[model samples]
Target: MSARTTPSPARTAAFLTAYDALLARWPVQVEHLTVRTPHGTTRINACGPSDGRPLVLLHGGGATSTMWFANVAAWTAAGHRVLAPDLIGDPGRSVHDGAPLAGVPGLLGWLDAVLDQLGLPRADFCGHSYGGWIALEYALHAPARVGRLALLDPTQCFAGFRPDYLLHALPLFLPRRTAARARAYLDWEAGDGPRPDPGWREVYALGYADFPATRVVTGPRPGLDRLRSLTTPTLALFAEHSRTHHAPRVAEAARRALPEATVAVLPGLSHHHLPMAGAAEINARLTGFLAAPRG
Candidate 1:
């Protein structure tokens, strides 16, 4: 599928600048930690202090730990520990010797090793897009270890695919430079600026450049049965204008799957805006959900 094109030069430039600044003043000090999984010692980026309740932030496909840059400070300020790890095969700092786990089981295994190394008895898990899928899988497989689960506009709930993925994939058949330009254009569209730290663009661009095909594809079409069985309290936050307009259906499916889960569609935000444009709202919702007494 050909990449969808959008017109927004000013917005694109602003996003690029903001991203660049973020790279310069990276708030979180990152360390290269190793998790001894059955596959091998998977390298991951661990951040945040050891005093607060551990909150793991998992980034989406093609994105790194920086994806959660907008939320880390707020979460930390709220007295919750944050750990943002770059998905194994992605562009960020995580090292992948062979092909990392492709589906849900592999993702859970990697996360299990990470938690074991950190000595976290149980922690809250938050995932966006593909990361959300991994988070759901982890909670299902290890319900006892997940204090709370939060998913932000995750894929797989609806059978629709994002246009950006199609665009990124199209470049494979084109020349390297053309593919690079195509990716840059798509990245600009995905990012929302007019905010903080202009250096984020360079970091995102580098990540995209380094790992163009970092997406993890699911094995088969698994129904929502597993998600329904989750005993942990779940919060599924849907962006108002997500590419997949199936929020209502997704929420319904989640409700049917896990009757205890709460669903809310965030207003005045698109899929790309949840982390950037709707940071405050996202943080507030998360804080409230985590603070609520368990069922």
Candidate 2:
């Protein structure tokens, strides 16, 4: 599709500048990698022992892999190899030069290629929002590969978006999405609750304004049969003040579907604040999940 093109040089430079500033806060050595996939060249921020337990992190929509700066440190310190890749089309370093993912299967194939390129047979998967959906999909698709699953206020898994959240987020999804509008929408999502880092906030807004998204492929949520049939261990962390879906409702559905999975509602956080503003609690919970032996 025409949407799978490179971003303007100026846009790339500005977005990278802000993205890197937060990335610098990762607190550990990092390696930048470019993996060639059937979809396109996937850019990854990799760190920790090469032989460490492999963990693949998927970033939320425009937030990019750089959004993991807060959570990576804790994981890396615990000796887990973390590879956070910017999704192919959504913006950031990954250039969607190849064909747009044919479908959700196409996206999973792209991830499979990325993992193969990185030399991971299987690994732990952690995702936030859109990223969580991907991880959940891939886990269900190939349960044999994922050791553990962590979802951070993930959207569209067990429940759909709340109308109020969609109403506030409508501008960012429209044809003329801009940084100004994105900033307003983000602020509204945060509300009187905790705000994101000023640096992260800047990059988050710029991602919407500058990067003209080519294709965003979000399919219907996994069917209840697939959710119930899931064999991999899962942890679903919902934001208490999320402007999106009701946390408890989704958590209840998640529990009903995956009775053995751990589900909890984090206090005083919004959906947009995930994997960032709620790092402390999120990191602790994540470390515990990751450190646990696979059953």
Candidate 3:
């Protein structure tokens, strides 16, 4: 399926320039591992220590592990090992040639293979947006392997219906000149400086170009019953300015779904910027939650 609209030349050029600069700054370490899934060889960026408690970080759709750039250092510094893997089909280092595990089961199996390959019996799981959905799926399917779970502005609530993407891309769909200006506006507001790394831009671009299916892989609606069944200690972080207008509703839904879950809303942040905007808070909460004694 084609994108609703083609990216304008100016927008494309701007994106390319930003991407080129990003690659020069943050050079990620890439690893190739094969999973049992039919998707074939999967590539992941394995950062931080291998000896520390394995903390797997998953990024939202249209984003790569680079999204965790700001959080990795803090997480690692706290003595917890961190693993930021590019979702298989996304534009990160991971490759998806054949059919990928689309929904919850597919995601769980893919993650299981990653853990098995790394010789990790279990680890703390944290995901942002789409990653959050996958993280929840893993916890639900393999509760024994997930010591703790953190969901950052995850989707699939409200019966799997959300308009966040439309809102985020609305500016891009404006008039060409207007779109260019809007894009520039975002770049400026986001700090036009080079990204922490260059490869991140490339990875993100690749996902944008190759992984259109990501838009359709929000996963199934676990509903309230499934959410209530999750026994893993969970933390749900919601951005104050989430594109999902029903932020309060979603948060309330999550709280009700996982009655035992720790729910908190970070003020003065949007969906895309939460990973960075709430880095310190997220790190602190995650550290405490993960470090806490588990039954």
lDDT of each: 0.65, 0.87, 0.65
TM-score, cand. 3: 0.76
lDDT of 2: 0.87
Residue-by-residue lDDT tens digits, candidate 2, 73-108: 899888899999999988788888887787888888
Model 1 Cα lDDT, one tens digit per residue, 127-203: 98778878877887889999999999877753455565556546643544332563454454443433322344455
Which pairs in model 2 have colliding backbones?
none
RMSD of 1: 6.9
Return the lDDT, model 3, position 64. Answer: 66
lDDT string for model 3 (1-295, tens) is 1111223444345444544354334333323344544554565555555688888888877676667766776677777777777667655445555554656566677788888877889899999987888888888899999999999988774334456545555554343333334334344323422222334434454435433333345455686777778899998988776665456778888877878888988777676667776778887888788877866
Best by lDDT: 2
292 in model 1: Cα distance from truth in Å?
0.8
Candidate 3 Cα outliers beyond 4 Å, as residue runs: 1-37, 158-215
Model 1: weakest 10-residue lDDT segment is 1-10
Better of 2 and 3 by TM-score: 2
